[model samples]
Target: MRSIVIIGGGIAGAATALAAAKAGLSPVVFEAHPASGEDIGAFLTLAPNGFAALRELGVADAVAAAAFPMTELSVLARTGEVVASRPTSDSFTLRRAELCRVLQTEAIGRGIPLHHGKRLVTVREDEDGVTAEFADGESVRGDLLVGADGLRSAVRGLLDDSVVPRYAGQRVFYGHTAKAAPSEPGRMVMVRGSSVAFGYTVSPARETYWFGRTHGDELSPAEMAAPGWRDHLVELLRDDATPAAEIVAATAEPLLVTNTWDLPAVPRWRTGRVVLVGDAAHAASPATGQGASMAVEDAIVLAKALRDTANPLEVYERLRRPRAEANVAASARMTAGATDTVPRVGSARRPADGAVERMLAWDAVLED
Candidate 1:
């Protein structure tokens, strides 16, 4: 049996471990966090492809229990008129921390060995296998190494130094409202402004998950986290004449400001026995809402590739790269269109439904 060593215990890492176990690989995971990933903060929507990947990994129901069903995406203009309504497939909205917690729990139940506080500092591969050296003076060797790390991946550096994360000139602040938002539980409401945009949804219990984004240079580390930032953010959008001001005012607390980033097609995703997955290989702006789903798909497709192919790394890259690249482009396009101007309800057409359906359509990737 060929052993697999997977780095980073976020969504991609956890799902990879489960899929590897299903392939009878019994891969071990190394997480930089102390114990769990329930602290990533913010929230996300799991698209249809994400749900399909979760179901394949055998944890869809568990994740669903912690998430709120989201079926429709209603795009509105600054004047509170609906521009378009798009139907979604089997989607759910939940806190990012909650999603990580459940993926960890399900991985643990499957007997996948996960080591916390194992921040990788160096990676070396020889003729036969690869060794991962962690910050704690511990090291492990495996026949192959998989990089499920995030955007600033140390493992990606080991693969090639060319793929740098590029900022998209936008930053977003995400938080949960202390009071229930007026948004519908089963729907997502988005209102676009000239320089900024806001989208929000309600949980099963009426709590709200909301995010606001604006185009600007990257914020300083201090300003990204300074106290009362939530209030400042509310003030910035107070004149939008939407529920954005109210939502920000009611948010419990402020989380970090995130500079939107995505990588152009990388020069390399695999080197020797080491390969990259998820954000490490392809980072997309949150505007896409397909990052997690693509990551999960990478895990499933990777596990299957390992199970059925002699050259698993090459096969995994061949099968997954095109799909990931397509989404990256789509995300850039959508984010650009959404921010072109204050979207008006009656004047413009929304993104083509066919384009969205193409992105959401993934039976080909999931078929046995």
Candidate 2:
């Protein structure tokens, strides 16, 4: 049996572990954080494509139970005019931490060994197998090593030094509030303000989850740590006659803001027995909202490749690189404000069309 060593215990890593196990491979997960629920500040939408991938992995229902459904996406202009509204294709919103917890739980229940605080420090690869050395002075050897360690991936560096994360030309802010403007359940609203792009959705419990993005220089550490971000965001929305200002003003918690970052392209995704997955390979800006979904897709496709082919790494890259890099390009355009339409909640378009759906279908045999 082939043994897989996976780095990073976030969505991509955990999902990969499950998929690999289903493919009859022995997989172990190493997480940098001490425990689950480390990054709960930000939330994301899992599109139909992502859920479809989870279904293939046999965890869709578990994820759905922890998420709030979003059925429609409505866009408003600066003058508060309804510009566009469309139905989303089976989209659900959940906090990042919640999604990670759900995936970890599902992985654990399946008896996959997941080690926390095992930050990888070095990777050694050879013709026979590969070894991963963690920060805690423990090391493990496996037939293959998968890096789902995200944008700042240590594994990616071992593959190619040219690929580095770049700013996507925007500063993103996230906040939640119960006192915001009344919203219809199952609907996500996007406000195209004069200066900022804002979106919000009310949870089943009636708490509003909202995010705003503005194109500017990246915030310094001092500016990000300083208070009064709520006031700053409210001021940016003051001139627009929309609910964004009121929603932001009513936010009681300190808003979390960070510079949007992505990798436009990677020169290499695999070297020897080590391969990259998810954001470690192809990261897109949040403007497209397909990061998590794309990661899930990667998980499924990778396991299929490994199960069906002798040269799994080469075949996996050929199958995944095109779609993943396209998403990166699309997100770059959206973050640069090149398009007027806010990418709908699920995908820029229904990426889960017939071909993609067939690709994600677990029973379908992968073609070499």
Candidate 3:
């Protein structure tokens, strides 16, 4: 049996381990976090493509139970007028922590060993296998090494020194609130105006998740205080006449801020017996909303490639590179279109309509 060592225990790493196990490969996962469920935020959207991959890995139902199915996505102008209403058909908004729990449970059930606090520091590959050196003075060897380690991937650095992360010049604030009974669930609302965008999504448990983004370098410590930053977002959304005013007004605490970043286009993603997957291979800006979906797809496709061929390096690169590259290009386009200021909202029409569907419709299960 081929033994595989997967780095990182995020959604991508967890899914990769599950896929490897189902393919009859012995897979062990190493996570920097001390536990499986840690550092994940309030909500994330899992489109049809990601759900399909989860179903193939036998954990779709578990994840679905933790999510609220979304029926429609409405894009609105600053004045609260709907510009476009796209039928979601199949999508869910769930807590990132809950999704991680479901994937981790399935991975553990498969008897896949997961080691926490095993931060990867270096990787060395050869014709026979690959070896991963961890920060804790521990090392592991396997027939193949998969880097699901995320955007700042040590494996990616080992593979290519030219790859670097670039800031997308946007900062995001995210938080969750209890859902009111009269509130509609399973609807994703996006309000875009000026240089700001606010997204609202409700989960099955009646919890509403909110995220607001704006182009900026960084927020000072004083700017992050409750009254300053919180009030700033309130004013931004209020100026746009967003419908969730009561929800935003009720929050007394400051929202958590995250800086959006992505990698510039890289020429290659594989080296020797070591291969990169998920954000480690192609990190996308949050504007595209394809980060999680791409990661899930990467896990499924990489496992299939490894299972179908004896030349792990060649087959993995041949089958995975094209798909990852296409996703990277699509994400770059979406990010550029959304962030660019074109005066008239109609200029942004093409991107807001079909970008999501095009990403969710990709069939990563099919081999090239």
Candidate 4:
């Protein structure tokens, strides 16, 4: 009952492999991509809770070394007037590719075999264990199977065809520019423009990372990969007096665009020897910026559950559902423009008695 099979080599999969290894379980990763550096253009900020989880997995320092700090966040109105300014302690920003490479490298260093280009095709479970068949005609047997594939997960579809990712009513665009704005060394600026929610931060290397969300029709894959999103986004921000328009106009790199998607709830998270984690189980919109953070937290908790309990899947779902769903609901609210308050990353069921802190503590024993 020690061998574990992990599907998907994204952030969730790699992180989970590390967590499982740390918990004394034998785990291997199967990634659909040919390499670890897909989605290199996109970037995200990892909150403190994410770092807490990474610390538990013994990879925080490695991950942090590839990221730059984000010390403050400032919110602005459409008129470019400052609405709120607050410090965001212990937050770091880095490319999505860098994060994946760091985690995968760490997992390989720990002797966890990661097989790329192995796409999961089907799963068969017996009374003893589960066997996963890949598209490349390879198969592996393990005592437990974990699905960390992501929003459009093959495992989720196989588990229950009804569970699918839905659009969250907005199209998000991300871009980078060498042209500097009026940004501080470690401050992120968010502008609530007339038709777009925009945010930008300057990296230590003087590149500006910015993203904008606009209410619009869902884009086709061809449209998303097209080269005109920068001009379209600039036009959307033209009316606002904020720096969003100028920053976007200065971007020379191809702008990345995609429809925002989320799963408010997954009717079932597990069955027998199979369980889901990260976006595969509960994916939230990017409105709250907690997707990666919540995913890392999932890895830590799921590993702890496996380490401490007989019913690892049930125990892991029981401990994780509430917080993960809270993030989904909050992100939905923000994406729908249902709230006027500034979006917060961790507005979930975080108790004041240090419960979440304890949950991520590697030395702390988990009680089922």
Candidate 5:
């Protein structure tokens, strides 16, 4: 099997395509969108663990250089009084679209074929190989098939129909301020209230990124797409003492909203010649800020497993499932904790260790 077909053109698929090429296989990446993530995507945090994985992939330096590394992160109340603080090191923030663009560029630079507008519709696997049929009616055959598609994956359903994505309690609203927030390198702030939580950070580009998550019912499509959504968000957090409302008011960028979702332990991750990766296999809520990091790690580990073993799917699942599942649970707890958004009372002066460090301090290398 010298050929592999990867579904999805996001982080996981891009990374996988690059790794597959490096492993001396022909890898083709298919994306459902007409163009690469040009108009969509929010900000993402890359912890040290994510950086380490990028380093192994030989793109860490470039990425770190292009991103804003956070120097300190503090957990505070709506009034902005600190309850806990963590000195963040080796953690960076970048636009999700930029990250995907960089990874896609890097993959293209390495001579990988990435096709856009190919929506996967059906997946068929026989003893000989597997084929992925796309919406355009074109089908691609390969020795191995990897479903690195996002949460709602058609390929995933083919592997196990029982695996489905569920909505978490809250939704995320993200945007960039029209005027940049203060340029503070390595500065990260998260404030929680009893019902709503908000976070704001600056990218290396000096653009201010902010997200607000509130525990509430699903919004109607009209409300979600309304031109007043930004104002609606501002009003949602008006009582909170955080800068979220200010950020929302100042943002000229298009407001983006997403209903956060996650999956429980998948009944299975692989079947026959097909296997799942990234969110397709196990998606964690963004509450822990580990979703993207986990995706990157999955790409690297999956590549290594494919290169080293005869049963690469089994090896990949064995090594990745436990950690990925644990992270999913941690994310759930973090989200639940946000439910009680009452910012803690008093000033927390001393820097405290955060689970972020322990979670970020991971060994992602695939041992020989």
Candidate 6:
């Protein structure tokens, strides 16, 4: 059996471990956080493409149980007028912690050992195998090394110094609120404007998960901790013509503010037996709403490639590069539309439609 070491226990890393296990490679996962699922903010949308990948990994049902399916996406002008709408065939809105719990459960059930609190400091690859050095001066060796360590990946830094995460020039506030009775299940709604935008989806349990993005260098920690954050959120939503005020008013505790950033595309994602996956390879901006989906997709495709080929690194690059590039480019374009300085008349279309479909349609399962 091939030994695989995956750094980072985020969605991407967890998914990769599960996929690798199914591919006959027992993987050890290293997570920096001591606990399995930490408070990392609110819900995320797993679109059809991402959902398909999760289904392949055999965790779709568990994830679906915790998710509310999204059926439509509405784009609104800053003044609140609906500008464009798209039909989403299959998507789900679930808390990020809930989703992580599902993935972690699935991974553990498969006998994948997870080492929490192991922060990766360095990774070295040789002809024999790859070795990962931890911050505590411990080390582990494996047949392959996968960097799913998120945007600021230590693996990425070792492989390519040129790859860097760039700020998108916008700060985002994210949180979830308990919904009042009579919540409708449907598509995610985006309220777009010249200076600000709000997007949300209602979870199955009648909780509203929403996010607001604005042009700002940073948000004060005090602003995030204010008891009246909801009120300030309502003021921001007033920029939108739609019912943003209503949604903002419905929100509750633990509002989080973070600067949005994305990594520019790297020329390659592989260095010998070492490879990068998910955000480490191609971090996309949240404007595209495909980060989680893309990461799931990466795990599926990468496992397939590695299991089927002797030169896993080459195969992994060939299969992942084009798809990751498409997503990275699409994210940049989507960010431009969402944060357009000039108000546009119509809803902005996602860039490179065929690219997303191709990723979703793959059906191969790797076996050694």
Best-performing candidate as measured by lDDT: 2
Whole-model alpha-carbon lDDT for candidate 3:
0.72
Q: By the lDDT metric, which is better: model 1 or model 2?
A: 2
In candidate 1, how many Å is residue 80 off?
1.2
Residue range 1-368, candidate 6, lDDT tens digits: 28989998989999999888877887999998889767468567776777877888889999998777787777777766777876776677777878888998889898999999898888877889889999889999998889998998888888888787887667777877776323356657777655567777666666677787777664566755667666776886665566667777776655777777787667768877788899999887777667787788788777777777676667667767776777677666666564532212121233475544443333543323
List CA RMSD, all candidates: 4.4, 1.6, 4.7, 1.5, 4.8, 3.9
TM-score against truth, every candidate: 0.90, 0.96, 0.86, 0.97, 0.88, 0.87
Worst 10 residues of 5 by lDDT: 342-351
Which stretches in model 1 have alpha-carbon errors above 4 Å? 336-368
Off by over 4 Å in 6: 181-183, 218-231, 338-368
Q: Kindly give the stretch of ten consecutive residues in candidate 4 with the minimal lDDT sum.
A: 338-347
Determine which window of 10 residues in candidate 1 has minimal summed lDDT.
Answer: 341-350
List model 3 lDDT by residue over 1-368, tens digit each.
28999998888899889888877889999999887667465467786767866777778888888777888777767776888776674577776777878888888887999889998889887778888998999999998888889988888888887888887767877777774423367768776765566778665567678777777785666655435566676776665555655556655565777777787676668776788888898887776666777788677667776666556556666655666666566555555556322111111123455543332232333333
lDDT (0-100) at residue 93 of candidate 6? Answer: 78
Off by over 4 Å in 2: 338-341, 348-353
TM-score of 2: 0.96
Please estimate how well model 4 matches the true structure, expressed as its whole-model Cα lDDT: 0.87
TM-score-best of 1 and 3 = 1
Put down candidate 5 lDDT per residue, 1-368, tens digits, no spaces.
67889999998898788667766678999999889775355887787677766766777777876677888877767776778776766677888877888889999998899999999999888999999998898999999899988788878888778877877777878887646665374678776764567777776556788877877676667766768777777787788776667778898745887777899778878886888888898898777777767787777777777776677778778877887888788777766664544321111111265422322223333443
Model 3: runs farther than 4 Å from truth?
Answer: 179-183, 218-227, 338-368
Q: Compared to the true structure, candidate 5 yields what TM-score?
A: 0.88
lDDT of each: 0.78, 0.88, 0.72, 0.87, 0.75, 0.75
Comparing 3 with 6 on lDDT, the higher-scoring candidate is 6
| Residue pairs whose backbone atoms clash in candidate 1 | none
Which scores higher on TM-score, 1 or 2?
2
| Model 1 Cα lDDT, one tens digit per residue, 1-368 | 27999998999899888888887897999998887754466788887768877887789999999888887788767666788797765888888878888998898888898888899999999889999999899999998899998888989987777778987767888887657776667778887654567888887688888888887788888878778878777777776767778888887675657778898677788877898999999888777688888888888888877777777778778867887887777666665565633321110122455432322233323222
Cα lDDT, model 4, residue 267: 97
Best-first order by TM-score = 4, 2, 1, 5, 6, 3
